[model samples]
Target: MPSRTLSAMDDHDPLTKAISPPPDETAAEKEARVKSELEAKRVSDAIDDDIDKQRIAEKRGPKPVRVLLLGQSESGKSTTLKNFQLMQDAKAFRKERSSWRALIQLNLVRSIHIILDAIARDYYPSSRPLMKDPNSSSTSPSVSPPSHAMPLPKETYLDPELLELRLRLDPLWKVQEQLARRLMIHESQWKEGLHGGREVVVNSAVAWKDVFTKKMANKRESSDSGRINWDDPTDPGRVLHECAEDMKRLWKHPLVQNLLEKQNLRLEEMAGFFLDEIDEITSEYYIPTNDHILKARLKTLGVSEHRVELNAGGGLGRDWRIYDVGGHRSLVTTWVPYFDNVDAIIFLAPISAFDQVLEEAPKVNRLEDSVMLWSSIVSNKLLERTDIILFLNKCDIMKTKLSSGIRLKDYVVSYGNRPNDFDSAASYLKKKFAGIMKEDSPLPRTFYCHLTTVTDTLSTQKVITSIKDMLMRDNLKHSTLLL
Candidate 1:
C-alpha cells in the first residue's frame, strides 16, 4: 500500500510542480493564474473533443475511392486525369481552360524550337554533340546513337529561305525559356539537345495553373476594357502570333521535312505537337480546345493529387481521389508512400515506346522499363490487395508506327515471327504484361487490361465509365463484407 502511494505520488510530482503557482503569490495573482490555467485547459480539452469527434465521423463516413496513375514520362497519365476531370466535373475543367493557354503556347513553341534545333544540327554537322551519352563509358566499346538521333544524310542541304526563317524564329526560343521559367522550371530540368533542345518540367506541388490564372487576373485589373491586353510586350502569345507565318513555313519547307525524315524526327507522333495547327494556335486570341489541353506535354516532376465527386452513374455522390505520380526513373521512389491503402493502380505501358529509350536512362528501353516496373509493382506485398489495371496506352501511336513499317520485332526481339500488325503487337505485349502479373504477384488478383488511347475523349470516357462501375462494385462489396 505504501509503495503504491509513493508510485502515484512520483507520477504526479513533475506535472504538479510545473502547473503549481508560485509560493509567494498574492490572492489576486493566484486567482489570475488559476483562471489562465483553466482557460488553457479548456482549450486543450476542446481540441481533444473535436479530434475525437472527427475520428468518429471519419469511421462512420463513406471512404473516398482512391486510385493511383502509374506510368513512365509521356505515357498519357496527365491526359487520363484530365479526362476524369472532364467527365466528372466538366464545369470545373472548363474553368481552367483559359489557364492552359500559356502551356499550349509553350508546347507549340517547344515543337518549333525542336525543328530549328534539328536544322541547326544538319547545318553544323561537325559541331560538338548536343547531348552527352548517359550510357557511354571510356573503357566500353562505342555505343550507337539513339534511334531518334539518326545520322544526317551526306547530301543534306538547308534552303537559304529556311535559314532566314530560322533567324526570324530565333527570338521564340527566348519566349520558350521565359514561359518555362515562369512555370518554375529550372536549368537542371532543361535538357539541351534533348527532344529538340529543351524540355519543360514542373513539380506537381507548384500551382502552375494558378500562376497563369493570377497573371490573367492582374491583366484584367490593369486593363481599361476589362480584357487581356493582347498588345502586352511581355506576352508570349504576341510573339507566337508574330512568328506564326515563319513557323508554318519552317515546318512545311521541303528541305526541312527531308532533314527531319533523315533524322527520324516525327514531331507529329511526339507529345505537345502543335506545328500542324500553327495557324489556329498562334491566332491573336487563341483558346485551347479540350484536345489541345490533353495533348499538351507538360512533364510532371512529383506527385499530384486530384479530387472529384462522381456526379453520374452507379458512383453518384461518391468522392474519388486520383494520384498522378512522376514516372521518371529517378522519381519512381516517391511512389511508395502512395501505394499504401490505395484502392486501385492504373499502370500505363506505352507499347509505342518499344523503339525508344528512356530520356533519363539513355540505355534503358522504355517498354522493357515498363515491364520491369510492372513486375516490381505486382511483386510488392504492400500492393497485394490493390487492384492493378494495365493500360497499353498510345495504341494510336503504336498503330501509326506499325503502319509506317517500324517492325516491332526489330526492337522486341523476342517478338520474333509475330505479325507486325497493331492487334497482334498489342495482344502479344498485353499477354507478356499479364504473364508478369501472374508470376510475380504476392497474391492472386484479377488482371484488368485495356488498350487505351487516352487522348480520344469519347472512347476513353467509355473506358473510364466501365472502370468506375468496377471500382464502385468492388467498394460496395468490401463495405458489405466489413458489415
Candidate 2:
C-alpha cells in the first residue's frame, strides 16, 4: 500500500464522521454553526487570558510574612495567635464571642468534673490511686492514676452533701459530651486514644466556630428578636446555670480544698481552669470576654493557619500568615513540612513547667521536653537561616509556683543553691535556651528572647508589636538583597 498521511487517516476517523455536518446541510446552517463556534472560542480565550493575568498578579504582589509557631502542648501558641487576631482584627475577634462562650462553659464543666472526681477518689481510695506529687523527683507531675488497677469496694463513705451535689451535677457530664460532639470531636477520636479524660481535642480543619454560629443563626431567625433564646431546654448553658450554686459549693468546700492540697492536684495551674469564675461563667446570659477566650483551652489535632493584615509598624499594609501547629509529641513530625518556607519561628518554652511532666510522656519533665524541641528546631538545616524567637512563656505561673516555696533546685538540680526567686529562675532558663541556639544551630542567627505570659493582653501586645517591627525590617532587608 502507498504511504498513508495522518490527515487522510483522520478524515475517516469515527469521531470526525460523528461531528461532521450533514451531507445536505444548508448554507444558513453553516453560517450559524461558524458563529456559534467562534463565540465559544472567544469565551474560552477570555477565560485563559484572565487566568494568566491572575497568575502574573499573584507573582508580582507582595509576599506575605509567614511565621511558624512551635511549642509543646499548652505552651501558649494558640493564645499568641489569638493576640494577633485581637490586635489586627478586633471586630472579627469580638464577632466570635458567642462561639467562645460554649468553649468557656465546657472548660468550667471540665473543672467541675475534676473536682468531683477528686472527691470520689478521696472517699473511695480503693477506686483509684492518689494523684502523683508533681514536685517529686521520681515521678511526672501529670495527674494520672497509678499503673496498678484496683477494684472498687461495695460501699464507701462520701459526705452526704457532697454526694447530693455530685448527683445534681450529673447532667453536666452529658452536656460536656454534647459540646464535644458539637465541636466535631467524634466518639472514635476519644476511644482511639486521641484525647485524655474529658479533654476536648478537635482537628484544626474543622470549622468549630461555625457549628455554634450556624445554630445561633437558625434560632435567631425563628425568634422575633434577633437574639439567642436562653430559654431553650436543649441549650448547654441552662444546665450549667442551674448547677451554678452547687458547683460553687463543691469548689469552695474546705474538705475539697484540703483533699486537693493533700494530693498535690493544683487545678488552677492546669489549662481551661475556670473554677474561680463559676458565678460569672455559668450565668444564663454568659458571654466570653477577651480574657476568657484567651485562657480557654481547646487542644487541636493539626496545624491551623491564620492570616492578618497589618496596618501599623514598619511593614504597613502588609499581610502576614501565622501557622499554629499541634505541639503534642505525636504531632511534632507534622511540623517539618512547614519549616522550609517560613520567614521566622516563634518557639514557646513553658519554663513554669519545671516541676510538671508531659501528659503524653509522663516520665519526661515538661521543661526538659521543651528544651529538646527547641534544640531540634534550631539545629534543623532547613530552618538554619530562619529567624528564631524564644518565648520563655508562663512567667506568671512560674512566679506563683516559686512564691509558693517550690524550689528550682529540687527539680532542676543543676541550679544548686541559687536563689529560688522568679527573676533568677527565669534568667537562668533564658540563658539555657540561648546557649542551646548558639551551640546547636546549623548557622549563626540572631537570638530574640522574651519572657511572656501570653494571656496578659497589654504585655503580649507590646511584645507582638516589637516582633512585627523586627520581622518587617528583616523581611525588607531580604527583599533588598534579592534585588
Q: What lDDT score belongs to each candidate, Candidate 1 first?
A: 0.75, 0.75
Error of 2 at 311 (Å): 1.3
- Candidate 1 ranges beyond 4 A from true positions: 1-59, 126-157, 181-189, 221-233, 313-315, 475-483
lDDT of 1 by residue, 323-434 (tens): 9997476577457555678778888888899988887887999999999888888888888878889899999989999998999999999999999899999889988999
Please provide TM-scores, in order, for all candidate models, with all chains considered together: 0.79, 0.79
Worst 10 contiguous positions by lDDT, candidate 1: 140-149
Backbone clash total for model 1 is 1
Model 1 RMSD, rounded to 1 decimal: 10.7
